[model samples]
Target chain A: MDKLQRNERIGILMKLLTDSPGKIFTLGNFTEIIGSAKSTISEDIDIIQDILDKFDLGMIVSIPGASGGIKFIPSISSEKADFITRNLCEELSQKERILPGGFVYMLDIIYNPVKIENIARIFTRQFYKKDVDYVITVETKGIPLAFATARFLNVPLIIVRHYNEATDGASVNINYVSGSKKKLQTMVLSLKSLKRNSKLLFIDDFMKGGGTAKGIMELAKEFECEVSGIGVLIKTAEPDRKLVDNYFSILTLDTVDEENGIINIRSSR
Target chain B: MDKLQRNERIGILMKLLTDSPGKIFTLGNFTEIIGSAKSTISEDIDIIQDILDKFDLGMIVSIPGASGGIKFIPSISSEKADFITRNLCEELSQKERILPGGFVYMLDIIYNPVKIENIARIFTRQFYKKDVDYVITVETKGIPLAFATARFLNVPLIIVRHYNEATDGASVNINYVSGSKKKLQTMVLSLKSLKRNSKLLFIDDFMKGGGTAKGIMELAKEFECEVSGIGVLIKTAEPDRKLVDNYFSILTLDTVDEENGIINIRSSR
Candidate 1:
């Protein structure tokens, strides 16, 4: 490959760093790829960091040591996060989202790639400090949100299904009661999913009674793992006390009045 | 925002365009955001496009005439795709991945964020020309892959579940036979999931008889939609004739010899 100009180097560096958040890259690595000196690459990184900071995109953290290197951390300013959450609350509170059973139909919002990415950025900011090894979630509605969170955190995702599949081989299953419904439900995870003593972050679309979060904690015990962090898109207001105490939620749902076509929701912040 | 420099403008433009693939952005929009002249923004875009071409990251497409603007399309070089597929084949054929019942454990690979991004890039290259409205998949293993593909294509993701939830409101349920197992299975999707007369792309982790793909086609018909493209990460060699005639696959699984601990797999290309 030929030598790259400063602008080209900045573009390439920005793309590479942002694409693989949390992955370390030594100065030598970039020097070899771009055919530049270590000093020049270091200067390029500073410029990229400045751009990232100015745009509120993310930050570049430089580690100091023999094996130390720089990595990208996905984050957003508090003001930006608040703005996004407010917009989400407005979109979700629309009367048309109410269904027959007082449920706010949120498939469009949760399954949307762009919106999920924004939401995941907030979750990543909340949980990145935990040094989570994996992002786990129950199947169905929470998969996309959890997947996006995992991507932002640069961790492997583990999905616990309601049932087992032949392709998963030997698995561990646990039963837990739903927090609000008090109904028994089985959570199945492949035995090979997690390493022993690993830390997990549980992400979900909704949390009514925190039953699912507690269930994940219990399931984590079976693998000799721990649920260090929990984040959800929405939580109910009536459940003043939840099964688990420590959690981050983007929005709070006060009520959904099917009769009046009213949805009372607000940002958690 | 202050007046940006050439390198900073390039970095910002690259990040914004790549982050939201397929979303149109007018030069006036960039001028307002970067506080630059329209002509300056146009020149910056040309430089960015040149850098993208040199790096094989992707291309910045220009759209002319009224109501037209430039958009980013996620793609990778054919050589890079081939290299990634070959590496995957090597890793998957390792004897350790072979499990009981001749099943290969692939949760780690499918759930991995970086690997899924690379694989999704290949899928985007394959199906982006279809102008797909949504990327659809069944629950469980395929969610992450489908989500990544939807992100790259800048479309909403629709997950068809095996059971119904009240949060989804009214749904349409259909029963189909599993391709390899020949057992009847049900797929449920919310009635409001897809728009009428929309084009859909089906993506999955694995395919044996392509029954799931075929079922997606059936489900599309009920919604007055059409399945415009199908892409899978891996397909079996035994089923020379699949239920679907047209589809794209990245790898082919020939056989897994349980006794000898030998697995045969190769890139589809």
Candidate 2:
């Protein structure tokens, strides 16, 4: 087998420590991988840390005492985030995403890496700009975008369920008229969970009637928290009453007519 | 207003380049911001380019003889991502989430930065370990996880769509049974796309019934790529079939009953 070099060691070390949560490493065990001296490994570790710093991807924390080597935190800065959002907005514009009821069929473009990273970065930047403390979304579709935004901002995300369960006690519920359903329904955050005056960003997969977003707004107000902003994967070009104050989208489905073979899309970062 | 600090100046410089795309800037603008000398600004730009590599975010591209001040490419890499995953798994286990119907509410916690960062790191590490060339996911919910995974791996992502459109000329489609629909649904992917023999890690928001996963698996095979592994934000304790080959999950849902206020969560990440 070819002997592992410093660059290889750095790559392996990143692969190993990145998925970890704390700042502790087993140095004795770590140096065994490349079979290199601890001093040599230490120098490699330094250079590796420099590379990580360049990317704005947190840092490598070394533990000094025995049973310690290195760890990682989740971090990123704005300048280092160009490729991500730029790619997302760019690819999203390429889709012929047209569906009925102002819905967009953007499954293809949204999945691309460059776009996803950028979407996450842009949404997070907006959320942070608003100083949102947390992220909120309804079940199923909104989950992915919410997760990405939350990861970028390093904030907690809340998922609201339509139905009530015994496990989640004493919920605050609200209802309003919404798509087909006679009444809109939503559950409030568990009291004392997110603290009063907390700011949150509402995320959804697609926005049409705005009923779900309205319901989330009601839930946020019930918690005595503020709705910092809203974001979505796609928004219909046709205008509708927006429920939240501020929002952005990756793609706008200008129109989609299955029979006419007409689908229009434009990017919105 | 106070003058922008040197670090902030660098950030602003990156922003200008990112927003303008193919544009150049001269030292005069730098002088206006920090009141620094042209040479100082030049050195600052040099330091930025040298220190922050990969961020392909573009470069100083000094044109010695003419038409250039600076240009950027916009890129970044994953380096110090080792210590976040395990911590995320551990924090995820602590959520104590249990809801009926075997649904674990870790999605909320997974969105939480307290552990979400770790989860993202761990996921990225897995991507590198598997040497995945790309990250794959379905739309709506999977976008965020896919984005995070892609961000960590610094790879491209490809999203699969539920339905086909005329815009996607000459495509390949596959049918997989769905748990919610209880019927086979056709998912589409572009043909001759996704470099053949590319390594991919499939990620989703949640997994149950194994049908959706199997469908994703088939989608990858359609592209002539090898499935490196499978990952999910949450997984049902057990399902009738296993959709993934090698899977990793932050939390497992054991039971969920809407009426009994009963939910059980199991963790073995």
Candidate 3:
């Protein structure tokens, strides 16, 4: 095969990395694609890594050893993350956005591909080095964010459904009490969704009392999987006692003044 | 800002294009990002486009006009698409996948981020030039695919729920008959999900009878919106008369031989 020019090689490398985020490509892989010497490919990767770092887009990690390979980890700089959090807080703070039961109208932000993609970058960076086998989330609102995170992680996304559906087939349904409302809720997952002992990362659109997260943990346990980490877009500040601890959130909703049409939201930092 | 070298410019351009596929970026935007002249940026874009073409990855579309800009439309080559469709067909053809009813156990594929991402690129390319305001899908299995398609299109994904939930908060509900069973079905969408007369593209994991797609159209009608197009991963061949006509599907499931565990599937050529 003929070697690609420097510019073209860099272009293809970026495309390959961006196409399959969190996937590691061995030196042989790059050499085969670019038809260049290992040393030349290594230099090109270093240049690409440097440019990515300088732009605050993402970083490439090269593992040493014959069995090691270079991996691309998507990330947003602190400044960018903060900006996104602040913007999201503002967008979600509108009085009209507050639902009757204190839930915010976050469908717009959660479903917005551009916003979710940036947020996914931030979340993926958190578990980039973790041994996460799958990204899990409950049905409805959390699906998009979870899918985004899974895409960046290059892993399969497992969704837990709220109601029994014929399509799921042989699902494991578990009932749990909602932490905030103390109401019974049932979450179901297909028996074939995940392999046993998989390390799963749970992500959601919102964390009220961590009831859903706890339920997810329980569900993972039922499958003999472990919940490696929990991430949420927003966690209510009033929930001083959460069912699950050690979770990460982008923003904290302090107060919602429905009367005055005001909401006090702060970035988690 | 200092001008970026050719290699660096190409790398950054690929990242930008990959980050927000199907979205247009003005030449001025690229020039600013690369800190170079518009001509240089244009040349760089041309080179990237050529490389993408040579690799059969996707295409760079340049719209000419005062309001025009360059758009990155992600696509899978026909060979790749056919391969994906064939693999998915085989995966879905298992007798175990065929539920008591005709529904197939599709949670795995729909939730699989990598597969959905590739399928999404195909769906997004189909409507890249259309004025699509939102990518709509029903809850459960279709959310991930809808989200993927929306992500590629850089649009908001609007999910229609099969059952009413408190979280949706005052949604627009519609009733439609399931095309296969002729049973009544209800689908609800948040009233705030879309604006009046917004153009929507509906996508789903499976299209048994196109009933859900038809329901989506009815729900969109309540908001005075129009469904520009509909795309599905699998459409059963038995349903000669579809509830919604003129929809694109990647694969058509011809027959499910339960006795021998054989599924006759064909790619939509």
Sort every candidate by TM-score, greatest first.
Answer: 1, 3, 2
Q: Stretches of candidate 3 above 4 Å error?
A: B94-103
Q: Tell me how far the alpha carbon of residue A213 in candidate 1 is from the true structure, in angstroms, after superposition.
A: 0.6
Model 1 segments more than 4 A misplaced:
none
Candidate 1: pairs in clash: none
lDDT by residue for model 1 over B1-269, one digit each (tens)? 77998999989998999889988899888887889998988888888888888878888878799877899887888988998899899889999889989999999999999999999999988888888999999987999999999999889999999899888889999999988889899999999899999999999999999889999999999999999999999999988999998899999999999999999999988
TM-score of chain A of each: 0.98, 0.63, 0.95
In angstroms, how far off is A145's CA in candidate 1?
1.1
How many backbone clashes does every candidate have?
A: 0, 45, 0
TM-score of chain B of 2: 0.59
lDDT of 2 by residue, A33-117 (tens): 5577778777766765655565465466565666556665444565554555455445444435444443444544444444444
Candidate 1 chain A: worst-modelled 10 consecutive residues by lDDT: A28-37
Tens digits of per-residue lDDT, candidate 2, B172-209, equal: 88888886447878787655347887888888767877
What are the lDDT figures for the candidates, one per model? Answer: 0.92, 0.59, 0.85
Candidate 3, pairs of clashing residues: none
lDDT of 3: 0.85
Rank all candidate structures by their DockQ, best first, as comma-separated numbers: 1, 3, 2
lDDT of 3 by residue, B1-269 (tens): 56679999999998898778878899888776777888888888888997898787888887789989988888767787777778877787777777665566777778888888888878876777786989999877888888888878878889888776676778988899988878998988888889998999999878888788889888888999999999998888887789888899998989877666666778877
| Candidate 1 CAPRI classification by DockQ | high
TM-score of 1: 0.99
**Poorest 10 consecutive residues by lDDT, candidate 1 chain B:** B54-63
User: Which regions of candidate 2 deviate over 4 angstroms?
Assistant: A1-105, A119-129, A139-145, A160-197, A204-209, A222-224, A232-237, A240-269, B1-105, B129-133, B137-144, B156-199, B204-212, B219-226, B232-269
